[model samples]
Target: MRKVLESLQRGAHAGLVLDRFGPLAPTDEKNLPERKDRHLTAVLEAAGSGATRELYALAFERRRSTSDPELSRSFQRSVDGAMVIGLGIASTLEAGLRLHQTYGVPFVPGSSIKGLAAHWCHRVLGDDRGGEHREAPLWRKEGDYHRFLFGTTEACGAIVFEDAWPIPNSIAGANGGLRREVMTPHHLDWQGGKGAPTDFDSPTPVGFLSMVGRYDFRITWNGPPAESATIAGWLDRAAEIVSCALVDWGIGAKTSSGFGRMVEAETGNRANAIATVAVAPVGNRADKRSSGTPARVTLVAARPKGGFDVQEEGRALGTLTLGTSPAGLSPEIGMTVDVQVHNDDPVKPQYKWPVASKPAKSVPPSKRR
Candidate 1:
């Protein structure tokens, strides 16, 4: 097997090599440390060729042309730190990295990109329902903007998030976008719940693969032409939100430990922001009054600093901060109340509840008891 692998020329499929050709220890012998290292090196080297670059180019062209030219947008960005994706995937080496199935290249999955964007939109942007089970407030309504961008359980979304592929020869090494990484587990006994960790225990160093370098991210509008203008506006907002999510919240596996963070490329130029069309406020006619529109908002979640995160008609209206509420009025989660909404500045709207307004009887099932 080793000789057959060695005879294979450059540009062989990396996924095939890693998955099938990986060296394994004999039944009698437990570990062959050097053999595993050599196998990983082979996989990395297989991805570092002009053939992989050409394959990625073809894939990128197909993805870009999947939607209309006018409705699609693409941008370049670089991973800020090591990105470990699909680490839990079963493999002989114990850790695994997601690679392109056919081309054997490192690429970010489209589902991952959309998932991160949706999470950022709900959590950071305040489009939440304030419950353990119902975190996606925007997905509740069929016509909600969030639902339009990122579909509901019933229908598909209007926009398509494409996988991000690495730029040709972006990194200095021969491994292309692939990087070797290691994780040392120190407290084996304590983790197994057998005994307390001691200094005398030996640490096991596990090897894995990660990714770094620039990648092209693309998003396209896939809705009807009649709704193109409105969908385009939402797509513009989504692109910005996705960028913020990648930089702030990160993506892929092990984000809390600083994996999968990305930032815009420092090329001093950016793709033109998607053109936005003016959209009429969506909701009841009475909610659009001139003086100050009255709205029934739900207390989604409490802010860490002060005040509550409120949502109206399944749309996030930003944070509602109040120094003090009227007497006999105590704010609670899942409670709905009437508030006056001022949209003079459409970008950032203001919310004000009258002193007469009181909490409505819309408490969540858990809160009722």
Candidate 2:
């Protein structure tokens, strides 16, 4: 997901093509305006006319008291439905992310959409009784829904590509994970002159990601419309919960890896402003006491005299005074600290994390994940 953001920022059209169910009706784009940003382009490319019914049935319906032929047909429908849903989700998220980024914000990532969908399946199956364990179980038996449903994870969990036949303008990772590659205005015949490019030259810049989630579950019905409506209402509630989970976990792709912000106010350039962070041992008190015997340890900020401030929850911890030199400065308290430094002018934010690199061996083993 971090790599996806980098790809977009570099001007690549990150394509997320979903393969699941049958085709859907053509969309009415006549009223839709031509989008200029990379994000919108990606969404348009992701649009699919399929339903997810087939994939869902194949993965969940074999357990029913239906015959193989009937279930097989249902499974096919589920596949078509899943594919269509996947494409629609991809398109919607692509557009939403582009809009957020254009406004200098972030939206969730497509990978998150997949993860949420997968989890939803896990939950529905896991909670069901009279079936094998709902959690993903290996060695699924033939005709077992568990085997069919969980079996697709290997195909759907990660985006992959085929060399023989590829997307018209798809981007590929070194190991060939399909990256976000959408169409661009330059490639649109409606805007560009003759010989206009038909594909993306680079991935789009991701400002933020918009998290999109959908879930499908069966509801018992004795043939009453009111019961059906009740089921619909329950699904809505589930959707809301899924949205909350995505936001809480930071599980969705929303911003550049190292540059994501907990609080994103439209302040001017902030890079020029110094950054200071309060570091305190948290979690178990016993663990904190055993590791740290020192009364205090020095904390550092990015700049001198930028007036870095610290806070915990909403209370003011204290001001961080940087000395004339770049040497470490001792903190005043023991509480966990959050530092803030902002200026009137917009500045490119700098990060302590490397832009691109894995854990270095220079660090101790305990520090390495």
Query: Who wins the lDDT comparison?
Result: 1
Q: In model 1, where is the ten-residue run with the lowest total lDDT?
A: 273-282
lDDT digits (tens) for residues 1-369 of candidate 1 = 845755565346777767777775545445577677777888888766545577667776776667665687777888876898778887767788888887787888999999988776666554333553232443334324566577667556667898888776674358868888888999988999999999988998877889988888888876444233444555666677677777777789989888988877885233332122122232213323343666666664455567755555534334566435556788886577767665522322446665465767787888876
**lDDT of candidate 2 over 253-302, digit per residue (tens):** 32233211221122222231111211111110222122112221112121
Q: What is the TM-score of each candidate against the true structure?
A: 0.66, 0.18
Q: Which of the numbered candidates is closest to the native, going by highest TM-score?
A: 1
Error of 1 at 214 (Å): 0.8
Which stretches of candidate 2 lie above 4 Å from their native place?
1-111, 120-228, 253-369
Score each candidate by Cα lDDT: 0.66, 0.26
User: How far off is residue 58 in model 2, in Å?
Assistant: 41
Model 2 error, position 44 (Å) = 23
Separately for all candidates shown, the number of backbone clashes (residues 3 or more apart, or on different chains) is: 0, 60
